[model samples]
Target: MLEDLAFPIERLGQAVTDVQLLFEKYKYENGIIFGHAKDGNLHFVISQGFFTKEDIDRFEHFNQDLFDLVLNKYDGALKAEHSTGRAVSAFVEKEWGPAAYRVMKRLKNVIDPANLLNPGIIITEDKQAHVHDLKVMPVVEEEVDKCIECGYCEQSCPSRDLTLTPRRRIVIRRAIKRMEDTGDRAGRKALLKDYRYDGMETGAVDGMCGELPGEH
Candidate 1:
């Protein structure tokens, strides 16, 4: 989820200043993109099935195009607010180029030659680290997957100031679903009973709207 890159406002496109228009042009159609455009920063998620090689290949190809758009065309960062972990570490050298990237590798080797702290996070020579053994999300039988955990819907949430948050609402649902799927009946019951109040009866679960949470 953290692999989504960032770009400059001017670099988003030639004429599009609006983030929504930029999204339309570049098309993060499957993602929910939102951020502090004032700082020329945005966060988005590409909800892809990462179980198979094909899925990894799709992400690799997508990253190729994205790298072309950001680094080659606009000179934007491969990373925004999010750090380049295993997800985008493969492209760090691309962003910094050979000389600078080699300098980065030397610095890493000098400090941590054994690769103890945060290995494969950055300064990696592995060309396929980004796509290797990608984590597969388990299936759940709830509409809660609609929530991207982007925190975009949290700040504006009224219940966040009062009772709960949109993200936490989905989180509770996911936990309950997990308990249910695992046949933890008692756990599921306790969770459902507790959530029946704020989650079910209040604004937290009003699908997290722009209006007052309970209005809908």
Candidate 2:
């Protein structure tokens, strides 16, 4: 929670504690700490001051200590909703424990035998995989390719007047395309869950996008 990080930081300035204790108490401050309270996992943004090798080492130790407090003490996760991607993949085992991690490895091996799909994510060789160099490709070729260069959807978008457009639809199309290309059924299912149907409905005929039965 956002308060969890900030409350501690504010307390530290007033509380009588050594620099080490202060460092230990508020290390999560160096990283962005926010997450869905309903889910119980926090997201973090480590300072870019951690760009150097020495800084990275220090941050890693600091993060390990913070995880020991936040995760082990509180029984929370290092990652809840987000995938064990490039950033937090190395911490999966630390969070999940060896038995659970082995099960995950087995599942990954069964599902992605070749490991060509997002390898080093969620599973990796060294335990110190840092979040770096993650790239995603477009997926929905049919919808994206059907643009016709007219920008009709943009013009017709209900939110366009409010300075917003259906950008998520484009993202969905790309996700669908990736699933089709990589055969990632789980990802496809997750992507499709975000879709909502809009337009008029009539008995035995839905007026979706102004289409009525056989009308062209």
Candidate 3:
């Protein structure tokens, strides 16, 4: 689980300590916390598994605890540094209160009344939408699993314009692996038709990705 959070500068010291302690309570000792204190902005990343009901329940409880602390204790922003997509859309009202949320809905109605622009993203009626589509990252292969899909290698790939970049190659590979695992033969065949050219034939295959920094 990763989140970008913000709090008042005065509470920076306490907030950081509290968050670390909260993770410890959850037994997530590997939780990483980092960001800038100048803006009281912190970004934390923690590895978690949702493969079991116990894992899901634990995450839900931890999420509630963190949100209560941020919203009630410190009055902080749940989404401080990134797009308030479906992940935080359900909490918009909790963060801004009902009155401001209503104004936002009215403004959205005036602007995109048709609801064609990124619907169920910034504002959503489904409270559990975020939990519904939890992504399970299957290990495709040891070499490709390490890619975070950050797209940093795309700019440097020699065949980026001609074919799939390093990131896209790995993405398609993973998708194909998922489809195969799920027995989606038709979908796999359709994707493989394009994958032959975009993912395989046009590659320079010069180990440029390996030379780039980090696991990717």
On TM-score, the candidate that comes out on top is 3
Sort order, TM-score high to low: 3, 1, 2
The global C-alpha lDDT for each of the candidates, from Candidate 1 onward, is 0.66, 0.51, 0.80
TM-scores for all predictions = 0.61, 0.46, 0.84
The clash tally of candidate 1 reads 0
- What tens digits encode model 2's per-residue C-alpha lDDT throughout 107-210? 98999899988888779876666634423434334434333222456766665554324443554555566686789888766655543332222111212223
Cα RMSD (Å) between model 3 and the true structure?
4.3
lDDT of each residue in 78-197, candidate 3, tens digit only? 987777876677788889999999999999999999998899887788776567677776677678877767578889988988888988878877787788889998988888788767
* TM-score of candidate 2 on Cα atoms, chains taken together: 0.46
Clashes of each: 0, 6, 0
